[model samples]
Target: MTPKEYLEIVHIINELKDTPRHCVTKNNRIESVAEHSWRIAMMALLLEDTFSDVDIDKVMRMCVIHDLGECFTGDIPVFLKTDDDRRQEAKLLDEFLDTLPEQLSHNMRALYQEMEACQSREAKIFKALDKLEAVIQHNEAPISSWEEHEYDLQRHYAFDVVAFSSWLSELREEILQETEYKIQQEQ
Candidate 1:
């Protein structure tokens, strides 16, 4: 790929840095989509030992690329995102990917397909981490930083996503414990 092409592609993805998600940071700052992606990538790296059966490297890639669509549509909270919202993100991201250098575009397209399928082990792990990361961040942020409905979202959001693996389920429970403690403290 030419240097010009590479930089241009990154410049487009740079939109994610400005895209904000619903999760707040511990400092009471709204976290960007890029921050969310970075944590899931970190979560994938940290899980390498625990999920030895899967291709952790690919999981990491999926984690990084899963939310690229947010660069275009910005973030829609899981509770509010509709099917059309998802379609628009995918469409815009697909258009952006097509403009990338050939192999990089191919790789990203494959990762997006794998993530959408959510059937392969790598895909499942990435998906679970994606959901869990938001919950983890919410738990870290002050109680007043959260919207009232998020308490319920934190309790039940990732249950099904992580149900395929006991380790993931256990991690979810640990996050749930933290959420319970936070709620108790607030009460």
Candidate 2:
């Protein structure tokens, strides 16, 4: 890649650090998209043993790149996203991908597409880790920071993790229980 191309990619990637995770409660300090991506990538690596048939490398890549569009569109909270938001995000992702060399852009685009499609084992695992990380972060945040409605939404997200893998489902339950206990202790 040319020096200009390399710098362009770096600039776009750097935007992730400034993009806050929008689903998280606004009362608490929010995590950047970059931070969320790092946690999801780590979770994918750590939890790979639970899935015997997934491609760990692809899962990691998907976790990291899944939100690249957010660097452009900003993080749209899942509950608030409309069809227009989805279209906008896809357009922004394509523009971001266009900044890279053809091969790299193609690969990253494919990874993002696979994650969205949620068809392959690796994609499914990555999707589970994405939701799992959100719940984990929410649990770590101050209990008082979350409104009742936010808690309900997060709990439902935890349950949705079950659709990907049984091991992740069990972990989700454990996280929910732990969060409940922590809230009780705070009371």
TM-score of each: 0.97, 0.90
Cα misplacement distance, residue 173 of candidate 2 (Å): 0.9
Off by over 4 Å in 1: none
lDDT of 2 by residue, 1-187 (tens): 9998788788878999999875454357777999899888998888667775778989999988888888888988777899999999899889877868899989997888787788888887888888788778878777776767776765677576466667777888898887778677888
* Residue 125 displacement in candidate 1 (angstroms): 0.4
> TM-score of the candidate numbered 2?
0.90
- Which residue pairs collide, candidate 1? none
Q: Indicate the worst ten consecutive residues by lDDT in candidate 2.
A: 21-30
lDDT of 2 at 155: 62
Each candidate's clash count: 0, 0
Model 1 C-alpha lDDT per residue in residues 50-156, reported as the tens digit of each score = 98888999998998888888888999998899999988988898899888878888989988888889999999999899999989999999999888889899899
Alpha-carbon RMSD to native, per candidate: 0.9, 2.2
